[model samples]
Target: MEKADSCRRAAVEAVADVEPPRLYEYIESVLDRASMVPAALTLESAAAMSPEDYVFEDQDGRHCAGESETDRDRTQISEYDSERIVTHAAGVQLIYEGLRLTRSLAHDEPWTVADDDADEGDLAILAADILVARGFYLLARTDAAGKAVRTVQSFGRDQTRRAELEPETASAVGPDGADSAPDSLDANLEHDVLELAVRAGAVAVDETPSPQLLAVATDLADAAGTSFPPVTECLTDLEAKVREQSLEDSTTDRATSATDP
Candidate 1:
């Protein structure tokens, strides 16, 4: 819960600078309750990490700092770097939520829109677009930007595949459509977003996530499915999982190094 709270605060702050009052209000409302699992995971991974090895020399071949200043520089880098990573996580999560909502409206048709009274549906569409754009804005300068973009691309492709597999109407689509269950292609958004979360988190501290860590992300995504549960419920033992994966990765690295010529 604390992690979620931290994530929410950071996410809200990230979007607080939006110029439009109404759009900002809509974004804030969504962030007020959006699942923070992705962002939380970023923070958790960051917490468990140490800074990357200090650069001994600049690109110009000049020494950057001495041992006396190394710790201070690392601390400063870690502080700002974690913020950037978590912000990227928040951005990706927003994009995922927006896409999810758009998909729900398109495929599920949760509500009807009268020809003359399309305000509600229009607003929802606008909000979804805004959320995704803002999310992209947040990730634009971060290391995870490419990953975030790919996640959205994957979501779009999967949705196209979903439409082919399952038509617009549930009952009318029949047996062929019925195979596309909630946990099938529909759940891929959650799966990919969670993986991105861990990756973004690990990279913040200069760590490449082990396969085991990513597997944990998959397991967590499967548990939540497409319902988008609160991260507090979904990531309850995330810290332990991260720690375990860290130790496992360290051991693998040691074994590999020991075997090297």
Candidate 2:
């Protein structure tokens, strides 16, 4: 549990000042609910776990502004993005979406969306009531509800995989534990989450189905082969890379806007 606490501490440090106190509390609750809380998590954690993860207004603005150009923005990027509403529900949604994406993306169809676009996608507002409110968001309101159902169904088909996935027992292991990698689909918890993280990253960056995205994730899987510390470090690196990329994108957006008029 020392590892979990360290992960939580790092996570807290990541958003202590930026996110509202309630949101931070909510995020903490979600992590605790997951039962396998890692030491530190990046935005990719949200993406990988909760495909329908919600974004705080400030976070979306940072993504839009590419505030990643500075260190301050980099430090504040992973605020409880998944727990937009109910706290622990983010954990449930993460499982649902990861399974959903693993099933959907397995198809040739594309699930790409701008980094911030998923904020309001049909899938964004889950109608789940298991842990939180049921019927909270009926499909009647979502323009993409039809597509969302397909995605959810796809995830449902493979529910067994999650059931088969073993929990990571060893604490703070790094990513080089190839020998320890379970023969199962995820190899273990970190692998499973990383797979979802990459998939989410692909969709968020509009790079789904791209080999490079998968490659990066695979590389991460190997590096963080099987533990929390490595996972934490991997998340930190991914966050910085994403931030830098966001900064560049923001700069380009500005340049294009200057030229377009």
Give TM per candidate: 0.77, 0.33
What's the true lDDT of residue 212 in model 1?
Answer: 81
**Model 2: per-residue lDDT, tens digit, 120-217?**
23232221211122111322232223333443444444344534433552443447653232323333434444444344333332333234334444
Error of 1 at 154 (Å): 1.3
lDDT (Cα atoms) of all candidates against the true structure: 0.68, 0.36
Name model 1 segments beyond 4 Å from true: 48-78, 110-112, 115-117, 168-183
Error of 2 at 196 (Å): 2.3
Range of the 10 consecutive residues with the lowest summed lDDT in candidate 2: 127-136
Q: Candidate 2: where are CA atoms >4 Å away?
A: 1-30, 33-93, 96-189, 205-209, 230-232, 240-261
Highest lDDT among the candidates is held by which one?
Answer: 1
Score candidate 2 by lDDT. 0.36
- The top-ranked prediction according to TM-score is 1
Backbone collision count in every prediction?
Answer: 0, 9
